[model samples]
Target: MAGSQGEGWRPARPAGWRRRMARLPLLMYRAGLGPLFGNRLLVLHHTGRVSGLDRTVVLEVVALDREVPAWTLASGFGPTADWYRNLKESPRTTIQVGSHRVPVTAHFLSAEEGGRIMARYAPRHPRVARRLCAFMGFEVDGSEDSFRRAGERIPFVRLVRSPAPGPAAG
Candidate 1:
């Protein structure tokens, strides 16, 4: 509801119940309920920047490239989100999509790329795109240009799967 009124709206970091609710997906994933969400959502396992402890966050998969084995995600809460920052410090991490855990390397996409991705995503998931843009303080008119502009303002990252380690030499 933060951006319901549109421009100049910036959502505050979630706290208390909201924070707990946001984290519920992580618990579900750990409980082996990940398949329920399918490939739409993924659990990102990362290291805390300051604490050096393991951390996990569930994020929606905005795009998926089976060929590259990559998943693109947007920072709904903006770049200040802990998970986003953590990836910056340590790009090497893992993600769980359904029952599969994949080793991946985070690659931040440029604004232009984000715009194109958003433009493509909007038509595929119109309602979600609208709501997501609104939640992120962007006013999208359902036009490709509007969605592209909104996407430009959002930070996106692509997690490309790392190749399996080769067998060790005897």
Candidate 2:
């Protein structure tokens, strides 16, 4: 009953122990333990839209085109997520994945584009795609079409890196 449309599948913000536990990986990354899985995950640093303070979050890379030094990420918590909003307020930011750290800009992708990305992604990483779908409240039947549908409902962003570290957009 996860991906039935409406608000049945919306992700709620984590709190208490859940919030603290979810931050463990970010802590590890700060402690120099990021390289272990940096190829697949990244630590994003954005300025809070309201607080004007720096914030960080770990996001799984949905797609990575190293040729362009760009990475795609999905907002499982929807477009209103804190980090997503933060990035919108300041598109210029930094991300660290493994040993690769770069200044990047966040570009929001249309749902159709997201669907296409997911379609291509599912074939390459079926297990991860399935898990992602489930986590996003998408109850897919393990089919590419279903996965694509789920992607259409999720907001996606493309992080494009600059040639050099740039000044903050804020």
Candidate 3:
């Protein structure tokens, strides 16, 4: 895993059994193991744009917006990542976080917004933030500026949950 995390790596989409095996973690979370991850990780249930089939992926939550009740995500595999593309094709989806599931709508964030978010995140989660930058094929000196630069290069999305039915509506 460490070798694959190198900056030179630019892996294409997983094929054959690899793709099938990747869903195992997602399954674990959906099968009531979500509490182990807390809010840092989430399981996204989405539909493939071309295949029109439901898909699931476990992603790390880069940021959380309590006010808006949203989770911000980053594509470590770059902007053209399959799940990211799929969300763009169908913005409406569901996310499972810490034993809870909710309907969400995807909203792409600007590079500047990503920069600000990354800068703020670095101090709070220094080790994880650095690891994330490394995994994303970036190098950082553990500074907010360095993290911001790396963040600007990655694609981020804000997943805002849909409003629940009020008592009057029900």
Give the per-residue lDDT digits (tens) of candidate 2, residues 76-145: 7888889898888888888888866789999999989999998998899999888878877788887888
List candidate 2 segments past 4 Å from native: 1-9, 164-170
Which residue pairs clash in candidate 3? Answer: none
Please rank every candidate by lDDT, starting with the best. Answer: 1, 2, 3
Q: What tens-digit string does per-residue lDDT give for candidate 1 at 1-118?
A: 2245444445777899999998899889889999999999998888888998888789999999999889999998788889899889988888889998888888999999999999
Distance from true location, Cα of 110 in model 3, Å:
0.4
Give residue 152's lDDT in candidate 2 (0 to 100): 90
The C-alpha RMSD in Å for every predicted model, in order, reads 4.7, 2.5, 5.5
Give the top-scoring candidate (lDDT).
1
How far does residue 147 in candidate 3 sit from its true spot (Å)?
0.7
**Residue 6 error, candidate 3, Å:** 14
lDDT of 3 at 116: 89
Model 2: how far is 162 from its true place, Å?
Answer: 1.5
Native-referenced Cα lDDT, model 3? 0.80
- List TM-scores for all candidates, in order: 0.88, 0.88, 0.81
Worst lDDT run of 10 residues, candidate 3, spans 161-170
* Candidate 2 lDDT for residue 109: 97
Question: What is residue 103's positional error in candidate 3, in angstroms?
Answer: 0.6
